[model samples]
Target: MPESRRRKAAVQKKRAQENVEIEKNRELKGSPRWWAPLMVGLMLLGLIIVVTAYVTGGNYPIGFDNGNYNLFLGFGVMLVGFLMTMGWK
Candidate 1:
């Protein structure tokens, strides 16, 4: 009931709340289950896109096949996406 006691109680409660928040953040960061599957799926999707581009010839001009270039570009984009999904690791 004293003013000093009330202030101390408030401070203690704030500290407890901060501790809980910190723990929650740690649990989230430490979990990799979601990241692993997401990155893999992205990488696979990129591969599919690149393959499709190659098979379609990417509408290259001069009667020459340029699908490989498209494939490489798709792969590059996929790599970046994968890395980003995996936290740039």
Candidate 2:
């Protein structure tokens, strides 16, 4: 091939590779619109639950009489929220 043609071909190939990489990155970075908000809400809700339980003397805020279940439940929920955050971009 001529030098000019070779250079043109190389440029085109490079551009095609770049486009493919861009598309792959776009796909990998794609996330639901609600994902981040939901994760933050979950974290906040968990924090609120934990704080409420502590403030209320660990009473059953949801009408149950489990002594310290509320605290554990709050901690569990918070931990789940924290874990979900790891999946966020």
Candidate 3:
């Protein structure tokens, strides 16, 4: 049986709406060129800081030499990088 003209039109309209939504989503699909590099760098920096603190035993003789505070600083940096991932796509 043939679809009624009104029913066909409604389906077409719905498809058009879906297509528009898909295009809108696509527009938001990519991060800026520097975004990914910055994100990864921050995460790596955090890892390095944490490792340095452990190796130095908080006695590096510079700022952030405190044991627990260095850990907190490293984790805070890592957290920011992780949070950035949520907006990446």
Best by lDDT: 3
lDDT by residue for model 1 (1-89), tens: 45698898999999999999999987667535677667777787777777677666675322336556666667886986667664722
Query: Comparing candidate 2 with candidate 3, which one achieves the higher TM-score?
Result: 3
Local lDDT at 32 for model 3? 85
Residue-level error in angstroms, candidate 1, position 24:
14
Segments in model 1 whose C-alpha atoms lie over 4 Å from true places: 1-29, 59-69, 85-89
- Estimate the TM-score for candidate 2: 0.63
Q: Write the per-residue lDDT of candidate 2 for residues 1-89, one digit (tens) a residue.
A: 45788888999999999999999988788567888888888888888888888788777465457647887787788888788878777
The lDDT of model 2 is: 0.80
lDDT of each: 0.70, 0.80, 0.84
Which is the better candidate, 1 or 3, if ranked by lDDT? 3
Error of 2 at 67 (Å): 3.1
TM-score top scorer: 3
Clashing pairs in 3: none
lDDT of 3 by residue, 22-55 (tens): 9999997788888888899999988888888788
Model 3 alpha-carbon miss at residue 63, Å:
3.0
